[model samples]
Target: MTIFDKFDQLAAARQALEENCGDFFNMVVDDIISATEAVVNGRRMILAGSNNYLGLSFDSDCIEAACEATRQAGTGTTGSRMANGTFSGHVALEKELAQFFKRRHAIVFSTGYIANLAMLSTLVGPDEIILLDADCHASIYDGCRLGKAEIIRFRHNDINDLEKRLKRLAKRNTNILVVVEGLYSMLGDRAPLSDIAAVKRKYGAYLLVDEAHSLGVLGENGRGLAEEAGVEDEADFIVGTFSKSLGAIGGFCVSNHQQLDLVRYASRPYVFTASSSPGVIASTRKALSILHTRPELRRRLWDNANMLYQKLQDLGFSLGPEPSPIVAVRQQDKEEALAIWNALVQHGVYVNLVLPPATPDGGALLRCSMSAGHTAEQIEHIGQAFAAAHRTDQAAQTG
Candidate 1:
């Protein structure tokens, strides 16, 4: 028997998709013009799928910084930080992140997934317990599995469920860690951090907020949902990524707790993985500066999101919980989702087509993420494309 025989079910599913949907897995972007425009399959398309929130990917300053860093520090860091990967840039970036978040310590990781993995896995032990949100990102779930802590899940965004679980655990003397996200990526909904923080405080549990999707998109200075919800002081750790708002590749965890710096010694993911490249660090630093200095970018992003969301809703399409940067259209089924997705692409638009198991509650999603770089005209064009696609789907159904 083949060792890979267990993946036959998945392989068959892929084959069926490709046969029916014209190679959905093999999408290739021929060129990227900007944060909101790209060339795919030899056609220029409006990009509504990329999560480049602040749209600093094409900023002149960030590009210049990345190029200069590549020239000075070479291409990559060849080893893990625990070995030889700790460069001056890495140290400087960590310090800057600590200052930016007003935290006592900050630790950088190769990627956001690794950041969550390192922090979640290393913070708790067998004697402790982890309370997780059911709808958290996969990285959080993996981190929970890597750790020795007993894991428990509460309903997604249900503060009452969380408090009930905390009350039940009140009699136990075990340490507790509560994990949640600042902004849930799939739904583009902000967490009720104030309420969650209260529950954590009542239970005397550590609260960790993963701000991967919310950083640079919330709060007065774009710190995240914790800051927006006025619960930053209550959160034990604020974890985020540079890839989204910062428009680069890296991740960081900041905390008021001085002991957070010690996670480097315990986290296998951080200890074993190679550090982020100097170019990434440089670009990210520049992006961070731009993110702070340019509040107009956030305003534009929200405006674009609101416009498109209103248009889609007016066209009779069901959307995610609220109007944020991310706008997802929940479909009747996988077939309907794929049909609309393909139609949009055919009409010179590109959005994410998320399938079952990957989507929440086994639903299919045509996810659209807005960038600050998107112009008002581009947003209107996208709305038209979506409306047209929906009309096409309706006509096909009736015919």
Candidate 2:
């Protein structure tokens, strides 16, 4: 009887969770003190869930840049980029990003999601096919849908599976677009870009890598997994977000192809959505500079990630394969996952509580993302809290 009838399953599931946990999805951090800590429910908690990898959100330079731009340009951009919203900062940032990636073109979007939507949807024609990783972010899937392209999903991080699909399309004359993430948000595992790139080359397909999670967390210059994996030349397009490593809110696509500029006119997301605010663009530019100048931040970020990952694994906690900034602790069921997540919060530690369907394997996850701002002591305390939370959950189940 209603347009929302399709959400019956979602509504029932949410209703069940609300009955058990009283709105766990609507958690609020009353005060965020820094990149690594926040105040929740009158208690200060270490923040392990936020994706502020380089912890540049509170950087003095970035804050100053944002303030200065805000003072000059006022608040929001009232029109889309195609209209009156194009500012000098926006254009400058795009040029800087293109230079940073050594690409011929760079186009900014309102968000990382929009970046994917703009590029994936606009770049492919109706005659093209999209070969995407099954575990790709929702934005990528949505973009493919928007383009109405024939979407074929390969197994997660399975290069062999991708090759199998590519081989099947060997005789097709349609354009092939293979999309994968630099670092998957859930498990933090990276795609085998070198092998995947080879497969793409064999099939004459274009490769696009989303570096949303990996930016500022990998590579010597923080260009992401493409640089670290030595496949920058192989990847035809790179999509990134200022929200993750740059600690601002925006998305971008960079490519050496001269034709990338044409997407600016063709992409609806880019043409319709209002461009990023001046303050955001300014701060992102400054943050990008910081990311390139201070490689030490990346080192600290990895140190924090390694410490937490090793300690959690030693405690017999099931974690995602491979050690990266993202560390997801798997739970046996939804109930246990919620219990442990609640216990962790009660112990003054905040991490993401991922439930079924949203999670990668139809299970629950205690997902933790590391930040360079987290001190050694703080990381140790987080490990201890996880141990205590696990013990508390186990005791409750046995009792």
Candidate 3:
């Protein structure tokens, strides 16, 4: 058999999707009108799938910072941080991130995925163990695979399951790292950080919380779920991405442990990958400042999220467990989900159409992520679009 034969199943699935839904997966934005609006397929559509939580992408200060940095520092770093890429702006952003997270040290990476790869693959060695949530991000799983450590997965957000696994490994006399996410991306459900932290402490294990989706969306100071749950001290390391809330491109690992500063030397991903562009670093710094100075952004974000979530629930849609920035409507049938996604687009709303096996469960999700930039009227419009889309799908099925 040819090597290409292995991809036959995937190719068949893609063909089916395209035939059914008109290629929604590859739909491109023709133009970005704002943080909450975009032109897709020559149609003005409300953006409800983008993870711009604080909605600083269109902020004048951020845009200006990016332009100024590009003008001054050129377009790209073109080298790894170990070589010629350690710019002044990069150092400054690291210090600011450490200060913002109240950590003693921080390390920046080219992307959030690499940040996980560097930490997870390097921190725990062959004799060590990594106990992670079953529903953790793909990056976390990939990082684990790159490492030599024995990986164990507990049920998602199940404190009892975590404790049981930790207890079984207690007598192994090896280091154990417990990894969890502050906010799960798919279902938008939150981890029981307080409970997980307590179990980690009881098991004498280290804790790592990936706040990729929770930064600037949780805590009074936007320090994420660890801070909101009052377990920051219990968490040994916190990793997050700027692509989400910071409205730029980069990833970081911040901790009280000074050893994190040395990961740059050993991490292959950090050593080999080119550094982020000067403009991205500058815009990220400006966005972080905005996140710190403007608490109202978080409030407005929650207001919009709550409104959309309530509207969907009122319409008898099966939604995620709780309402936050991410509001996902679960659908059991993939064909119906695709029809609804296309109908929503036709109604001038664009959302993420997540199908299995990517979904947390073996179901489809029409995922909507709220932004502070979304007006109340825009949120109402999104809800109406969903309602209309559902009706159209049902009518098609019945007809």
Candidate 4:
């Protein structure tokens, strides 16, 4: 067969998406939009899927700081962190991360995905073992693939299943890296941190919690799920991204072990990649300060989450396991899932679409994310749009 044969799946997928793309209400917003109501195609569409949990992307302070940094340091780093890429702003951001996590050692990477890739790939060699949550982000899976470690998976949020794997690892390897997420992105449910922590203790495997979705949204000071579950100090390593609640671009790994600093020298992704620009560091600094001082943001985020989740459920739509920053509606089938998604877009509502292999356990979902700035009325509007889409799908199917 010619090499072009490999393009079948990719081509088909693109065609399907393109055909339905025009019907979508939610998409990458090119304009500087503030508040939930914005003119898209001259229609006021409710923004729901943006990862800006704190709505800091539009915050004046963050935008001004970025502008100032651009004037002072220029637009790009012009080099990688390993060479001329490292700047004073980068050092300050690293320090802020260390202090925030209360760990002596912290390393910042270009992106959250690269942070996991660099550290996990560099830290684990041929002699190590890596056990991960089944629902972990693709970065974790990719990082493990880059390393020489044997990858093992445990059931999603099932501590009993994790304990079984850890026990088996203990019997063979003395060193193992156990990975789990603070909050799963697709399902919007949390892991059993306390139970997983106990398992880590019994087996003596190092635990690394990915707080990409939970940071600045969980715990008293927005430390993350580990802190909320009281396993912060006990965790061997904690990794997170600045993309979501942090309102910036970058990733961090904080550990009391101090050995994480060594990964700095060995990680290929870190050594080869360009460092984050001055603006990212500056804006991230401001966002972190707000996260630490303002507990009200977390409350507002959850309040919006609960309001939307309850509204969806009351509309007779099956929801995810719990009320989380993410809300996924159970679609009866793939066509219904796509139809409901397109209808929601037509109604000026944007959310993530997940189906089959994309979702866990071959299930399909219409994933919606909540932000702190979202209001009660806006959330109800989302539920209503989905309900209307559901009815539309049902009517079409019955006909």
RMSD of each: 0.9, 1.1, 0.7, 1.8
lDDT of 3 by residue, 1-399 (tens): 999999999999999999998757678889999999999989999999999998898899999999999999999999999999999999999999999999999998999999999999999889999999999999999999998999999999999999999999999978999999999999999999999999899989999999999999999999999999999999999999999988888999999998888888878889999999999999999999888899999999999999999999999999999998999999999999999999999999999999999999899999999999999999999999999998998899899
- Scored by lDDT, model 4 comes in at 0.85
Q: Which ranges in model 3 have alpha carbons more than 4 Å from their true place?
A: none
lDDT of model number 3: 0.94
- For residue 379, give model 4's deviation from the true position in Å: 1.3
Ranking by lDDT: 3, 2, 1, 4
- Distance from true position, residue 162, model 2, in Å? 0.9
Which residue pairs overlap in candidate 3's backbone? none
| Sequence-dependent TM-score of model 4 | 0.96
- All models: lDDT? 0.91, 0.92, 0.94, 0.85
For every model shown, what is its TM-score relative to the native structure?
A: 0.99, 0.98, 0.99, 0.96
lDDT by residue (tens digit), candidate 4, 207-239: 999999999988988999998999997788899
Q: Model 1 clash tally? A: 0
Q: CA shift at 283, candidate 4, in angstroms?
A: 0.4
**Candidate 1 segments whose C-alpha is farther than 4 A from its true place:** none
Please give, for residues 125-145, the per-residue lDDT of candidate 1 as tens digits: 998899989889999999989
Q: How many clashes does the backbone of model 4 have? A: 1
Model 2, 76-99: lDDT tens per residue?
A: 889899999999999999999998
